[model samples]
Target: MEDIVFLYRLVPGHVHHSYGLHCALLAGVPDEIIKRAEVVLDAVSKNNCVERLCNENISAQDDEYKNAMEKLLTFDIDSGDLNLFFEEIFSSS
Candidate 1:
């Protein structure tokens, strides 16, 4: 993951967010569940998600968010979706 991020930086004109999206997509996350999935990742381990986000200074584009999202949804699909966190995330901020 760190390697992926470093490469993203070395390459100019690349939006770092793309890396997140790539990750999400490869992890098999669905587009709809992204926000909740992000919230979950934000709450739990700050390792993969935050490190990449901060190191790259990237806020996800739809593509990158989706990428990170796919990873988020892979196993925790049911829990990661809006049906579970919609109210909490959107409602709070």
Candidate 2:
């Protein structure tokens, strides 16, 4: 939960707020699952930061820019049925 809150603070206004809420809900899961989700979120965050930096420093048409973006596009956060997980947690409580 602490990790999720910390990550939420780093989110930009342009990004959807639901991701932060999702992360907060994810915090209630097992430690192993939370750790894995955290890793994925961190990677996505880092990728976004790098994309922003590249956008400022390089031409959008440049190969480097395209490659960087492609990498970001390929990132998948298939943590599986997060809604179901949340439901189980809430029902159990």
Candidate 3:
């Protein structure tokens, strides 16, 4: 859970919220992590979903969010695989 929060802070804002949600889901995190992820997801959805925006813009953002999620899911953290995840994230940044 703390790792999730650290990862969330490590990523850029565009992908930060979704990163934590995806990581928590992929890692099969505990209830507390799931709850936190949901809050972040809800806030992000609300902020991104603008009523007057063009469809293309919305679609692009959705695509980017999905891509970010997929990227996070690529790392297998099933057995508490934090080192590789952290290494990948830090190296990439």
Candidate 4:
């Protein structure tokens, strides 16, 4: 015998989910950015991050770096089902 699982259809605006990376892929957001997005996603999911990963591949170094890092850290990817991880990051502000 097989166990049955129930799945409900997602109603418009009723569910909060972020598939930005998936959408970015379809919208041709570029391979490097997509890969970076995946890295960021993994970091968000795991709640652990290392400086080296964020420091290496980014092309800009000034305000872009600061802003990007801030936005990247604040993004809530857990979809209301999990707790977000917090940590001290590199910031002058």
Q: Give the top-scoring candidate (TM-score).
A: 4
Name every residue pair that clashes in candidate 2: none
TM-score winner between candidates 1 and 3: 3
On residues 1-93, what C-alpha lDDT tens digit does candidate 4 reach at each position? 674444567666533456667777777899987987778777666777834544533445656567757766777776522222223334432
> 1-93, model 2: which lDDT tens digit per residue?
244244445554556334654555555666755655666667676674322333533563475556655644654448556566546444543
lDDT of 1 by residue, 1-58 (tens): 3444424336555232435645776678896557656665564445454333332424
RMSD for each of the candidates: 16.9, 17.8, 17.0, 16.2
Q: Model 4: clashing residue pairs? A: none
lDDT of 3 by residue, 1-93 (tens): 344344324554465324655666777788865875576567666775423334786787777667657768886667657777666555653
- Quantify all predictions' global Cα lDDT against the true fold: 0.52, 0.53, 0.62, 0.60
Better of 1 and 2 by TM-score: 2
Q: List the residue pairs that clash in candidate 1.
A: 21-64, 21-67, 24-67, 24-68, 25-67, 29-70
The C-alpha TM-scores of every prediction are 0.21, 0.26, 0.26, 0.38
Global CA lDDT of candidate 1, please? 0.52
Q: How many clashes does the backbone of model 3 have? A: 0
Determine which window of 10 residues in candidate 3 has minimal summed lDDT.
Answer: 1-10
Off by over 4 Å in 3: 1-54, 78-93
lDDT of 2 at 6: 47
